[model samples]
Target: MKKSKRAITPEDLTKIEVLSEPQFTKDGTSYTFVSTKINENNEYEANIHLQQLHEEKSTPWTYGKYNNSNLSFSPDGRQVVFQSNRSGTPQLWIMHTNGGEARQLTTFKHGASNPHWSPDGKYIIFTASLHEDDDVASQKELSKEEKQQLTEAKSQEPLVVSTLKYKSDAEGFHDDKKTQLVSYSLEGNTFTQLTKGDYHHLFQDISPNGKQILFTANLSDNADYELTNDLYLLDLHSNEIKKLNERSGYHQRAVFSPSGEKIACLGHEYDYAGATLTELYIFDLQSGERLCISNEWDLQLGDYIIGDMRLGASENGPVWSKDGEKIFFIATDRGSTGLYQVDLESNLEILHKNDSHVFGFSYHKETDKFIIGISSPTNPGDFYLFERGSELRQLTTTNKEFLQEVFIATPEELEVTTEDDWKIQGWLLKPYGFEEGKKYPFVLEIHGGPHMSYGQSFFHEMQLLAAKGYVVLYTNPRGSHGYGQEFVNACRSDYGGKDYEDLMAAVDYALDNYSFIDEDRLGVTGGSYGGFMTNWIVGHTNRFKAAVTQRSISNWLSFYGVSDIGYFFTKWELGHNLMEDPKKLWDFSPLKYAENIETPLLILHGEKDFRCPIEQGEQLFITLKHLRKEVEFVRFPDANHELSRSGNPKLRIARLEHICRWFEKYL
Candidate 1:
């Protein structure tokens, strides 16, 4: 008899290693990627791993406690370059492909990251922070006393606010430091500042001929007031820069074609604000013409779905085919992200179709094969090798041991019909060791992003709830991606309207169909927009016995001025600024309905969360307490909005414990 798997525990999260940043060598015979694992000290440890196509196992290329990422293979396939924080600040490092002592490259004072190799492998381009007063033209290092003065100046307490975006969630208070493109030459072991500006410049790609570099920056005089990124091309020889596109939109992650004739990128206009689907665009470097090739395709490009687990990859690329005739990327459709390909003739095709999420992928033209990182509810992300006419083969099994020891609940797909005749897609996770006749408590989990989707990706929080004997139900409501753009935009001007109904309809559909669920013992929770919905749901109805809101928004009126993106996000998401329509903002705020909330609620927030700001949660908690309502507030120190996902591991585990305890006490 086979042994049954054990239920998953919160600590299991620490044991699972996340793999990402897969890069294929020029020969296409081997590949490299990054693996990040949490240590006993509750810190993330990252390293690079290499795997040959014919080999059965992958070997670690770099071993240490320091963080390392952004791996890129050299054109000659003899060496690899990546960014590391071993020296207390991120810097570029290069190592032989065959594995040997690594050599540190650049040692910039402000730090350097996102290393991109020139096509010839003679030079490396990266982004480094530069102060406004720093002279880039001089190319001189700061004196010891000057460095001390700069440090003391930064250590001052009071902040002199000048720009509208003076604070950021990832980077706390804004400084005079602006990220600019810089280059390092391997032959001379010298550094040169490529671009000079007060605004931040993000390096995108290097042209095939190595004569130009592609990057994006908000060069507008009112950059603090505008949230726009326009693509620019920099000539390497003359240092001349020119704008590529004249349209008003946010363009990012652009890459040069293999032939260096065209550039492909992911972007969108502010037609629907934050809820607008990201479209793929192709720009002709010669004619300076740009066209949205995916305009006809309604699905959103790239992945926006967020989960508690530490996801390794960001949105996959717009990689051009070796012939430069086709561009490949990922698209979120109906809750799953799939690989897609588009040709110059506007021919769109689904290269890889599945119900699971493809977090990252790389295609090597020499072999005409693809290496993909995929994850599902039952499987944590792993690398797989795929070819056009062959079966997919799992290349790396980083989480195989964890899967063998834990019983990950596989969610059952559900289709819910709302009163507005919209079909809402969702999933349900039955409690571990479920009994056919027993009535198990249920929890309705909502995802944030109102723009993101709740898909087939592995979610640690939902799995933990299932392991603790709760039927967890989560859905992609109307405002979510994967559906058509029309559906995603449905909840923009109308918050807590059809979107709330879509969530409620999901719960109703589950209770009516699932026989093992205990409708009376119900719980609800979500974060960010989902947290906002949880607050809204409790105020609107007492159906839920318990609720937990994390990093949520309670008052749009206050959120407009406090949040990092508040000023414009309020106008973008709610379609109203405080000055334009304060009444509408007040009407949509969940704190306004605090008096009606009867369900026991737990408010969890991170102190340093500038995105939603801890004030949002504090306001809601105070209002409910003054009303003598059932509420509890839990605050985490030195943590940001990403506490649940990338915060301190100990705090993340504690958050899970808090949620489980809150639900257990009330339900």
Candidate 2:
């Protein structure tokens, strides 16, 4: 096994807090999760914990450290199965729910993940990928000359791959190819292949009766439309796999109703022009008929307005209650996603709403309680249990120890009107230890996915900036997701046009309203599309004092050819392909206007980022240096686009710290 490394600096340790995968036992007496525990020696260790509440006292049922998590309890609650990489590759591991005798379930050379217990508790289903030997053999199948070429290709490290259409920030490590489903039996010690071939199947959920499995996959004939993944039902008895949803749309988050009579899932039907919108649908198990339960107006998932039914940031799939009469889910169409319980019989009524992001949830029918996993811009991830509709009670405080030791700023929501008369949403984070009438530097942080929303989730960089005495501003501009499809598609072909205006409008609004914000000391930073926007912003305006772009797109023309998903994303997102119009790609590239940038810019990238590619960073870095502009580059090895979320925890922390260092020095 590759030895785990520790963060060299104390600042690095403090910045990265490891807490994820909160799961509950059947009786609701205990919970299991994975988190990093920092020892007194300052070394970080990954751990899995089984915490139980007894006599009003929380006791550690079982706690051990070795980089484990993604826990799921068995139906009987006798065992807890999870995935871990301690065996060199991520594989399935199981231990008694009470935390005894941990056993490795799968010894396959290929990695296995996302373990789900069967209802009868006899088997476990998980996703698996190709083995290293298979990878090598596949490459070896080519002719001698071709093999030599591939070997040479493997040996030669990635250069500034300028020939491609789209380049990811760090680029070229492992080609994330196919992932499939498999089932294993505990008694027989035998594994069965449930799903086969090149397509990927993820987020698997078993039917209540253990008769079938529901998952999302893109196995359609039109492989080009892989982005439009649909739900599929796999019959364990007949080994038959059938597509569930009919529309040439996207379907995901399939959950079986308690009675096994129906299935609730989020359906996204896509028309031409490429708009991704989600709607809640309940499919009758026997009749194959689906009922659309949400407002027809591009229903955003997550949290909703209680009475009037408005959408805010919903893209969350529906969750069935213990009795299955009520479907609990989070939708953002109304406000930031709070917990909402929709009565399936009443056509989905909103139950609870909050101005925070609620991602995971569980309904306990026995106690008539609901457990929700929520996060905000200030708090990362924590559990909240709701009983009888009284005030919600917080269960865990994973980051409380660190948060108490540090000064953190709270963000204020600002409703600003755009020139288009649209009221865009934004939040301003004042510096910690903030004083009135004191001017503070500010950083405009943009989110990627343009389709992805920045919810009330704990952001290390945001807090770090606030700790560094900089007011941070982040907003969901027009092109951002969580609003309806109309809002997301608004920036379709006009990438840097209106979306840029919305972001700028947010900054303008914050500056006008927040007296403590220093306009001259402003800086900007973002990743992916946000990175593209940051590149666009600095070139268009010298208003910001400095900027940092992480895993950004400098040149769209190159991105279309180099990155793995470049061919599709460029065409779908930009509405133009290199084959259609090369000049159009160049016109939108940030590198096109690199000559105009005067901002002291810092560029950070991963060495193995396939989404944005390292070339994007090198291109921008070289251009800035050539222009005699201030620039610094930090490259993290073996990291990807997801580095901010779940990459090497310490490196993730370093990335946040480095960005703060740059903004503090330049802004």
Candidate 3:
């Protein structure tokens, strides 16, 4: 008899290592990345790791309690620059490739981040938050005492807001601080403010010749009312600025061509509002001609795939090949993310495709290879080396030991046809050590971003649910990204119409196909949009024995006024503003149909969640109680909308435990 492996526990998350942000050297001989894990203090601990193409082992370049990330290699590849919070605030730090003590570079009051090396490697460009009253001239003239007084005056707790977009979920209450572009010269050991204004400037990339820098900013007089971010170019020497794209749209991550003749960017015209698929575009520097390169590629460019992992990962670059004839980027398709290549001739191809999530990837032009960070149903995430014809080699074994000691369940890929003839993609995770004849309770999980898709990524919560002897099912409904524009836009205005049908169709397909699932023992749960759906499901049907809703929305009427992105999100998704049509908003609200709900409900919300807000949960809980329905509300102190993914480690574990306990009591 063989020793049985133990089921994965919530505590096992602390041992899981997540690797991302791969940066390759100019020569493509070596690369560096960040490896992050939860520390004993219940905080994320990230360090830089380096590996050579010819070597089989990877070594840690930096280690400490403080988080270090955004690794970038200097042009010469002799020094590495990264952002670290070891100094109490995030600042730029430089270390040798050979390994030694890292030297601190910037000591600004507000700190610096997003460091970009100039082509010549003589200067480092970065963005820093500066007070509204502070500027290069004012800072130089101010005495030490005056600076201290100004800092104290700005620190007062009172938040005076006059703009509609005054608060954000990530930054909290908006202050006077504005993010501005600045450059630091290594030769002179001096700093120069590049762009300044009341607007926020996001650094994109440096031109190949290093003569101009490309960035994006609103720069409009009434930025609060506008929903566009225009691309701009600034002359490094003359300080002259020029707008690259004249169209009114949101443009970001623009990279100049190797020859400095054109630029490629990721953005959309916003014709579909928030549900619009991101398209790729190329702009000619000389002729000022803009072409939508990916207009025909129905797929959404960049990563919108979601999992239970910590915030998944940020989007990678729209990197250009050395020859400038082709550009390589990431695209979310069906249930997976893949690397795609496109040419000027409108030719597009998927360079690498897998039934897994490619969260982050880097292309090494010189070596014609790739350093990709990927995750699947069983694997958390690791770095892999890929070439044209050679076999893909695993670069880092960050979680190999822990995986060998635990039992990991693999999800079975599924495809269900809806009553409307639309195909829905999904996955089913069987309980660990699943016996043939034993029927198990099933839980249907829904993803948050009604726009984001559930894919081939490792989800701790789903796996944990399966470990507790429940089969877990999740799917990409009509509005999911991996499909196409029509499928993604199908849910708009119809909220619970076809999208609801697609989810129910998925459940029907699962019950008919998977014999191990018990029909009577079914539960449903979700957060954000999924949370809204969970509420809708209970109100419309009694098939589910129990349901858990996390950071969800119950009322669109209140959501438009309370949520962070409510003002625009409600109109974008519901296709109706509160004042324009209150009846339409009320009809789509889940709270309006709460009287019909019969399934026991558990509501989980973060007190500090600005996106969905705790009020959404409160309204639902109060309504259910008024109707004498079985319901419970769990509120997490000091947590936000990201509580489940990137909240306090203890709180995340507690939330998971609560979900499991609630389902066990009913299912």
Candidate 4:
């Protein structure tokens, strides 16, 4: 090992600064972004920073232990409004551009978020969750003692369930509180509730003329069974609501043009359910016509590059040119994301495309420049200044000091041909402190989101494993995004079929090509869908000496009713529901092959993970123990499905240490 460099440790996450939510002022003279860091208390503290185009370093505009984000500049660019949790919940707060103490703007019981300024800057458009009986201005935050008393009283009351979607992993249990739009007037200092009822009005954008508002929600009579998020436009003057689409598809991320004459949309018709590729669309208000702008494009719109360092970075999606002739957006293509522009005639051209993850982007036509956030295998993330013709100059090096002290691994792209003649893409990292010729242990990592791809983004877990002397391998198999639409939908209804072969083929190709890989000492691990794959791998073969499955699914029968989205997700992905084809789901379940599992298995799960409940790990543990097989189980309290990505800082460290300890013991 070199004298100046040290291997990365789990605590290095505290030193890493996660930068996201990039935005430019109207004049393009200055920009603002959020930088998040883990404090000594093991909690996330994010603050907004401002920097001019020629400035060397950014100045912190806000500071505290509270989480601050969702910043928006007023029409005059003299004031900025943002949402903060300083008052125990997220509420709108505004401060002058010159910098001073920020003033709290809202005290609603449930708080306000996603603040946006109207064109005239008279009112700020935001959303807040409210029950039908709660008044927007009168229902305020309760005292600590009152909250405790209310909690005690409500604990004894039965949670009455009537809706099909009664719970969420984020919110825990069902309540009457639904998201609604409220306009806070800066001059009048009054709260005006724009929409209300049992549904949610997801605020998308306010018209450039300040007369209209665009949002999406399902107001259908049978909304319990409907999955559509139909686009709607609300006239602020008349308070009238109008639906834009025929209510056939799930549409969102809609924005109005600079002229306020039309709107751009990103959505899909649920052809492959959630696995369907997102297409772009345009709506003309003058002609009352709609056009699909990206009908011929096979790529998925928006950023899909998976990473762990992102925290509420603003991505300006479907931005129209100042003249309203073209729209700019980001798309994932072949394991990388890039910026692209499309005209009204469907002619598209790439503005920036490369082998890097463009996690966040902003465009300024006034100055013909853009600010983009890029990350690679070795870098965490940093913002860049890019003019149309000038070179992409680095603007911020948030991880410069951290990188100087720690060694970051650079992944080599792996190409493997599957059994079906299909190509699989992956990356391989060499173990730290390498010699000229030495065989080393290898560990394969599978990413969550059977739909989310493993791409050119920074992953702290993989880097830690490589630093600990194990060659790490991660891949994007079938059913992963960033490939074309058909490629992403290939693994549906055949979960353990071709996808398993693709992974095994990739491993075999890796072993054959890399002489430094020790064939006898192989370990495997994955989370969520990757967790299911890990379980399936152990049951199907004894090749891997050790295996770790995290937040996995053991039996689809129980998952069909237990998971938050299990009812429809099972049928959509597996082509079967609980009652219709229990046999098929059972056949594909890894628990069915428990008797064949010879590898030492480690099951890791979170107690609060509603998406993949802890019962999954329990089922596998009991089945394996009953069969006299080697097994272990680890359950994290109060952690959810996102435990690995955004869980409590201490628990995230513990999780990583457990993975390293297990692999070190066996591999």
- Total clashing pairs for each candidate: 0, 45, 0, 2
Q: Model 2 reaches what TM-score against the true structure?
A: 0.85
TM per candidate comes to: 0.97, 0.85, 0.96, 0.98
576-629: candidate 2 lDDT, tens digit per residue: 999999999999898999899988888999888888888999999998898888
| Ranking 1 against 4 by lDDT, winner | 4
Q: lDDT for every model? A: 0.88, 0.72, 0.88, 0.89
Per-residue CA lDDT of model 3 for 1-667, tens digit only, reads 1228889888887888887788787778878888888899989888877788788778888888978988778898888888998877788999988778999988777778999899899999999899866653323334457668876987885668888988888777787788999888999888889988889999999999999999999999989888899999999889999988877899998999999999999999898888899989999999999999887778899988787674334447699998999998888998999888899877998877888888888888877788888888899888888898877888887788999998888899999988779999999999988988889999999998799989998999999998999999999999889899998988999999999988899999999999999999999999999999999999899999999999999999999998889998999999998999999999999999999999999999999999999999999999999999999999999899988888888999999999999999999
- Determine the C-alpha RMSD for candidate 3 after optimal superposition of all C-alphas: 2.7
The clash number for model 1 is 0
RMSD of each: 2.3, 7.0, 2.7, 1.2
Top candidate when judged by TM-score against the true structure:
4
lDDT of 3 at 24: 80
State the lDDT of candidate 4 residue by residue for 278-385, as single tens digits: 999899999989999888989989888776666665684898888899999999988898889999999999888779988888888787788999988889889999
True-vs-predicted CA distance for residue 159, candidate 2, Å: 15
Candidate 4, residue 71: CA error in Å?
Answer: 0.3
Ten contiguous residues minimizing lDDT sum, candidate 1: 134-143
Question: Model 4: residues >4 Å from true position, as ranges?
Answer: 1-4
